[model samples]
Target: MIKKLFIIIACILLLSSCSNRVDKGKLNKVGMLVPETINDQVWGTKGYKGLLNIQNDFDVDVYYKEGIENASAIEHAVSEFKQKNVNLIFGHGFEYADTFNKIAKKYPTIHFVSFNGDATQKNTTSLRFEGHAMGFFGGMTAAHMSTTKKIGIIATHSWQPEIKGFVEGAKYEDPNITVLLKYTDNWDDGQKAVGLLDKLLDEEVDVVYPAGDGFNVPVIEKIKEKGLYAIGYVSDQSDLGKNTVLTSTIQQASKLYDIVAKKYAEGTLQSGNLSFDFQDGVIEMGKFSPRVDEKFQRKMKRFVKKYKETGDLPK
Candidate 1:
């Protein structure tokens, strides 16, 4: 019975393709639904870039919808994509996994994919970045670059395995390093991020970073105002705030999008979990500002190797 079910699922997966204009071989349209603004230059931006990568590299046409937050909104978005006959529907965040999975099931002929999402379902695939290890290196970089030996992470959400991995990364950077972690309850509340970073500054923490998307910019500005340090995530952000940024541990999620979308076009779309890490250089550490110094970079290089070797940060 199990063998039969596997065969059935495999058969469905093989038939994953559906033409947009008609049920033909080539796909002329791809739809991207985003939870945040694409110009966020952070989370949503990475996704938009990925979609563009696929669009530019292939013969398929692309359509995008952004700023989807509510549960109902996500469902509506997926339904809309299905109606338009998008060959591939890309959801940029894990937040959309549940809805995407459901909609994909309803439209198995339509290809669906998510970035940084863990859930798996028939006709649906999710990909996640190995930010835990990269976050560890980010934390280590924070440790080496900080003048106070005390750092802060202004998260936009309470916490989860994913965020915990970031915290664990910080801890392993130094058993003695004190990490002041706090949440701003939402990602777009840049003022709140600034306030949280301000409080950390009162405690005399010279370096602070925000792990939440779109929240990093404000705190980075605040860090500059207080003559402190900050880091970026999701994209190469060293150029975003010249001297204040220590570095950014960026996830090139868009790059992955390019690969998956193309494979999908070539009749080679595989249904499974896909991951990228620092060792693969998919997760890149951004260039540090001059303040980071030669010693800090050297220390980070050694720690990076230690991380690739052991699958964890140097303790």
Candidate 2:
């Protein structure tokens, strides 16, 4: 067990330390596709941050197309990348996957990555996180801090494995806890998310988390305006309003980008599949903002240790 953990740790160190570029000549172009701009401060921000980090680490030239919504736009974007023989294409959000998979289907030579998704192909891989592992933590934190047992989750989509993972995670932590969960079916609509937040607030949910891509700005604002607590998502967003945010679930974009770009450069890139669960450190909790209680801190520690030691959540 120690050996396995040490190896995982070693891989992490190596991946983090890797920065040698084999002269990222203009040989192959890379495209980083986003459903929204980095201005959103959530998923798109993390993805865009990943793109810049990769470019900084390696000498590769990156082409980015941001604010792509809808299947047609995504399809067109992928098609554009393939026509340019882009080395690797990174698509953010599950909504972009079907379109990417369709475009990647005909282009076997190009490599593709779908972030926050679990779809696959020979040249395309789906990379997802076990947010369920942390969702329990989020829930417990919310439960502890919430004046009402009512906590809320505003997700980007209605239902999916990732969302289900959060549901299972939260319920596993407290079966009797009341959670008000909803989805906007869109990632860019802060107005919609704000409206949802208002509704959840009407339900008396004090602790909330917005799991939409970059739409967290408004959510955090609402949390602050109402003098409530919230858990941030995608990146380490506690800094947005440190007083209002407890902690956050960060999808390590640069870390994933490092591994993918390294493997692709090494010609040993794993094809057809890719994923990073919480156990893999792909999903991590941000530093807790100041003033979090010892009780909630202990809960997070216990849950993390339980998962790490037993490879399962505590029931």
Candidate 1 lDDT, tens digit per residue, 75-173?
Answer: 787778778778788877777777776666677777778765655676778887766776776777787666677988888765433366656766676
Q: Count backbone clashes in candidate 1.
A: 0
TM-score of 1: 0.82
Question: What does candidate 2's lDDT look like per residue over 6-50, in tens digits?
Answer: 999999887766745444532366788876676665566677777
Clashes (backbone N, CA, C under 3 Å), per candidate, total: 0, 0
Give candidate 2's whole-model lDDT.
Answer: 0.74
Query: Model 2, 74: alpha-carbon shift in Å?
Result: 4.7
* Per-candidate local distance difference test: 0.74, 0.74
Alpha-carbon RMSD, candidate 1: 11.0
